[model samples]
Target: MTKLTSLTIAEARAKLRAKEFSALELTDAYISSIEKSRTLNAYVVETPELARARARASDAKLAKGEGGALEGIPLGIKDLFATKGVHTQACSHILDKFQPTYESTVTANLFDAGAVMLGKLNMDEFAMGSSNETSYYGPVANPWRRKNSNATLVPGGSSGGSAAAVAAHICAGATATDTGGSIRQPAALTGTVGIKPTYGRCSRWGIVAFASSLDQAGPIARDVRDAAIMLKAMASVDPKDTTSVDRPVPDYEAVLGKSIKGLRVGIPKEYRPEGLSSEIDALWNRGAQWLKEQGAEIVEISLPHTKYALPAYYIVAPAEASSNLARYDGVRYGLRVPGDDLIDTYERTRAAGFGREVQRRVLIGTYVLSAGYYDAYYVKAQKVRTLIKRDFDEAWNKVDVVLTPATPSAAFAPGEITDPVEMYLNDVFTVTVNMAGLPGIAVPAGFSEQGLPLGLQLIGKPFDEETLFQTAFAIEQAAGKFTAPQWW
Candidate 1:
């Protein structure tokens, strides 16, 4: 018999339907596993009672010979999502213990489909950092370690907790937001599959805004199939969110294992930047080869503006962050520090609440949006953003999908890269997808010389996630699943 904790969402779902195990029993197994894996610091809150209750309800539904898509499947919700009375802090001290009365659109959709909530997962404070160290809760330890070294490495961020939890088998899947490479990079580090749907594919309402234009909800799971199933349940048109797309959500699972014969997968020429590691280059080239072996054609295309994506992303994302974070002033909710005056109260509250990375980005955001510099920085970045989008649009005519390395390198030790600029470069291959509002999926391609995981990303046209999933399934079949050794 397989340990329930080791089962993928799809496996667990099938087993649940076959009466192989009760939902309560499965939930209990996960709860026990989570309790024992505390050193990873993956979850910010563990809602065992609520999870059990949901599982019980799912059991009853199953007994009646009917249930939702994810009946009894337990999932970890990111702290960035508003879970209506559960902790929704974005892992920032500023929103300390901030509970919402409403649930995020994505989470609500999952719950409505009978998915059990394990609890809120941790993340970088206000989604500002590349490493998980910026989280108020502390960094999430990657379950995977270098072969013989005992050093702990960061499970990337800002969706570190989601990625770590999924990789460690703490949850069947997890809800994560990606503003830039938050979703893909973390999944790459933790040996999990993560997908960031097209910008409006998943609603942003009540997800704790962080660069509203770039923030999109998706799922991190043990494998490509589980990710596909989770994304199907998480995506829906929401009346509350104006940005939510109105198209019917396709059954992503149905497209899996589909033939990729004759598919043109674009290998962007500009993605092979100067600083990319040789190991990563080999993994990416191997990924293209894997696809080619699956009867797909690999075409080296050029998205010339790719070099400008990182700089433009930094300016644009922080500019939006500055505007979005303004509402957190010591006014209605969250931390409030009493001061001599109103402005003092705001200053004191923010200074004590936000982490250094968050503060730094806020300052950068403010500076770009400030007088005299707004046109020079923010406005120019937006123009560059348009050009980046155009670059992708034109490439779509030449290719069915694009393949790139998810991160410049594999996971590194926490705090290993002291310079923030060096850390920002980690998104070199990923930021362009967000800038173009296209869907992208990161699947583990291979491992590094040190035995850490390396991932290859598949970027698809906007709202064309089905193609991406099909292609990812092809790669997943070739490379096979990469699971972290159970050192925890």
Candidate 2:
């Protein structure tokens, strides 16, 4: 019998096809792993019975020769996605008892593709914090650590739990949403491969809104190939979500080993800004050199708007988040506190239910969208976002793909950033891609001097996941396999 921890999605499928393993057995293996690693706090809730039932059904489909690529694979879903009947808290007290009647379109699509639901993973409350500490459920511990170092380092957020769970080998892959640096940041911190598919590639119908314009759902997996397989299944055109693109989904796995010979890889001069750590700068340069040696043509490019991305994103994201989160008043789903009057009830409920960081973002968002300041802040931010996107469009005209550092530094200790603005600066390299609504992927490139994992991001044209995956796959081959934390 093959142990589940060592298996990949492709390997698991092969075993199932050979009748060497049953879906029930695979589910049991994952459930057992989750039980053994309970201290990691990867999952906010466990739905083993639901998973097993789905696994049995998947086995039946396989028996009838009706299964697809992801048939019977147990997967973790980030709590930000609304899973019908599952407590889909965005790791906040505000949504403590909130359960949706309908599943998120991305979640529903994954189930339709034969993926069994493992459970919802934890995240930063309202997806606001870079570190997972802001989560009402508590911080998710990093799976990796140096020999003498403590194990309490952050797993990264707001998709921290998803990355930790995958790194811990609890699931073959997990669903993740990236608004700013959520998915890729966590993946980088935990030594996993995560891709933020082209904005609008994955449906956002039932996903808990963060920054509406920047939020995109993608897959976090052990490797690029697994991430690509999961992404193909998760993407679709949903009539319910107006933002869902009408384009046909490409077969992402078809181009796995596609040659990158003569492919133009743009190196943005602005990514290595003044504050970048020396180790990270060296890693980025090393990665570029490696790619050049692999037959890729590296060219220097300028995305002059890079400096404005962080500030523009902060203004735009919070402004949109403020608008999207307005539905959480006392009446609807979420928490409601009884009070003296209607106004008091709304104020009391929000104040009591929301976390400090969530409240902070709400205030920032509210202020930016306030009556007198809308044009000065929100409107100007939108204009800057347009310039960021235009920068990519012009660069893509010269190069097939752009390569840059996913983050300025490696994962930091939880609570290391006392100042909120300083913490927000962590997403500088990643926010621009979201602002531009383009696809970006973070793959493990190397490790820092402190032994923390470093990630290289590949940004591609809109709806051009094929090129993105092809480029990442080549990098993966060059980087070799990433080692997970010894806790596994």
Candidate 3:
């Protein structure tokens, strides 16, 4: 018999229905896997009791021949989402011990589809850093190690733990939110599949806000087929969130194995920045060739305002973050530090609660949104954001989807990047998709020279995730699935 932890969600679903193994047995295998892989620090909280209870219930449902789409699958939830009566902190000191009475719409949808919760996974505090080091829970270690190296590497951030958990085989899939490169970057680094759907594709209600306009929820899984299955269970239109799209959620898994013949695939010229690694460049060229062999027409295109995406994202995201995070004062909930007076108390509480990166971003946000600088920074970034979106809007006239390297390189050592600006550059290739409110999927394409994983990104039209799945499957089939050597 295969190790239960190594089976993908689709295989488990079929075996579960066939009564070959009980859901409780499968859940137990994952619980044991989590216990053994503690060095990765992927999970911040372990809800074995809850997971077992859910699995037993699923077993009963399966016995009755009545189960939802995700009927017996166990998944990890990112700390950013609110799970009723469970720890819901965004891996931040500020939200210490905070648990929501209400559940996030995305989590609720997953549960409605019969998914079981493994626990809350770690992430960057308030979804701020490019690497997972900013988490109050400590950085998540990538399961993959460089050739002949024992040095630990970062799994990429804000969805670091979600990606790490999927890569490490501790969870069937994970719910991850991407504000800037959160989902795709981590997946790229860890040899997993991650998708950030269009802005309104998933509801933001009950999930802790990072940047209102930029944040969107998606899934991270072992493979493209698993990712498609999980995304179908996670996405829904919620009346509680005004931004949630009203369109019907399609069966994303249905598009797998579809032909991409004559599909015009756009290759953005601006993405090939100077100083790009030769390994990444070669892998990218190989990806285009694979697509072309499958009858996809590769066309060179331009996203002229691509250079401005990073700076504009920094300005716009923090501006909204400052406003959204204001509700976390000592008076309401979470941490509190009493002081001389009301204002002093506010100052002390926030200072004590927020981590350094969160504070830095909040300060930047406050400074940009201040009286004199509002028009100069925030408004200007918004304008630049529009132009960035316009560039994609124009490109849509020529191609059905755009392709690019997911990251500049593979995973790096935990503290290798100390300078803040240098760390911000890690998101250079990924932020544009968020800025444009487009759906993007990162599929593992090849390995770096040091044997670390690298991925290729696919950007699709608004609410057109089906095409992304179709195209990404082509890449997956060509490149073959990648897995870590299981040193952990």
Candidate 4:
């Protein structure tokens, strides 16, 4: 008998519809896994009672043959989303006990589609940092370890917990946000499928604001089909979010095995940056070969602004973060430390509440947005951002999709890189897509010398997630799923 937790969402859904197992059984299996895997610290808050209740409701719906698309699929919600009345803190102490009365548009859509909530997964505090180390809830240990080494590794940021949970099989999929590669990088590290849909594909309304312009919601799942299904439920135009495009959502799963016979795949010259690992480079070339074997035409294209994307992303994201996070000054909600005066209270509360990484970004953001340095840093970065987009726009004319390594290297043990600059380099390959507001999917392609998982990213045109699903499925068919040898 296979463990229920090992089944992907697609498999679980089929079994549930065939009456092979109850949603209650599925939910209980996940809850038991969550309880046992607490040492990983993937979940900041456990909502067992809520999950059970939702699972029962789903069972009832299935009994009536009226189950929604996600009918009974259990999922972890990244702490960044507001899950009405449940713990939703974005894994930051500044948002202490901050549970919303209304649901985030993405999570709300999931719930509407009958997805059960496992709990709030851990993340970088206020979605800052490349590693999960900055979370006020503590860092999430990657489910995968180097072969024969007991040393724990990071699952990648800020969606580290989301990626870890999926890899650990605590949930079938997870709701994750990408503000400069949070979703894709973590997925790459954990060997899960993650998609950062076009910027407006998922609504920003009700999500804890973090570089709002760059932030978008997507799913981290065990496989590409599950990711496609989850995204179909998670993405929709919402009246509450004006940024959400008013386009009709397509059935992404339906496009999975579609032929890419004449598909043009762009191999970016700039993506082979200075320090890319040979293992990752070989894996990227292998992925390209696999796609080409399936009839994709590989073309060498250049996005020259790719080198400037990371620095500009740092400037733009933190600047917006500083502005967005300004509301957490202890006056309204969350942690508040009193001071001798109102100004002092604001200063004390912020300084005390925010983690070190969060504080660093806020200061950088404030400095960049400050009057004297605005044009030189923030405004100039915005101009660079435009060039980044134009670079992608130009590439689209020659290629249908862009193929690149998801991360420069495989998962590294936590605290391996102490320097902030070194850590920021993790996003070197992923940030460009975010800057361009393009749809990107990370699919596990191979492993490293240490036997940790590595992935290749597929970047598609804006609002063209269906094409990404199609291409990613072809890669998945070739590389197959890589699961951790369960150590927990």
Top-down lDDT ranking: 3, 4, 1, 2
Question: Which regions in candidate 4 have their CA more than 4 angstroms from the true location?
Answer: none
| Candidate whose lDDT is highest | 3
Candidate 3 to truth, TM: 0.99
Q: List, residue by residue over 1-488, the lDDT tens digit for candidate 3.
A: 79999999999999999999999999999999999999999999999999999999999999999899999899999999999999998998878789899999999999988899999999999989878999999999999999999989999998999999999999999999999899999999999999999999999998899899999999999999999999888888889999999999999999999999999999999999899999999999999999999999999999999999999999999999999999888887788899999999999999999999898889999999999999999999999999999999999999999999999999999889998888989999899999999999999999999999999999999999999999999999999999899898
Model 2 clashing residue pairs (backbone): none
Clashing pairs in 3: none
Give the alpha carbon lDDT tens digit for every residue of 1-488 in model 4: 99999999999999999999999999999999999999989999999999999999999999998899999999999998998899888888888888788989899899999999999999999888777999998889999999889999999998999999999998889999998889999999999999999999999998899998899999999999999999999999989999999999999989989999999999999999776778988999999999999999999999999999999998999899999999998988999999999999999999989988888889999999998999999889999999999999999999999999999888887789889878999999999998989999999999999999998999999999999999999999999888998888
Deviation of model 2 at 354, angstroms? 0.8
Model 2 has an lDDT value of 0.89
> lDDT: which is higher, 1 or 3?
3
In order of listing, the candidates' clash counts read 0, 0, 0, 0
lDDT (C-alpha) at residue 22 in model 3: 92
Candidate 3 has its poorest 10 consecutive residues by lDDT at: 327-336
Off by over 4 Å in 3: none
lDDT for every model? 0.92, 0.89, 0.94, 0.93
Tens digit per residue, CA lDDT, model 1, 1-488: 88999999999999999999999999999999999999999998999999999999999999998899999999999999999999889998888778899888899899999999999998999888777899999989999999999899999998999999999999999999899999999999988999999989998999888898899999999899999999999998888989999999999999999999999999998998776789999999899998899899999899999999999999999889989999889787889988989999999999988889888888999999999999999889989999999999999999999999999888999879989889999888889999989999999989999999999999999899999899999988988888888888
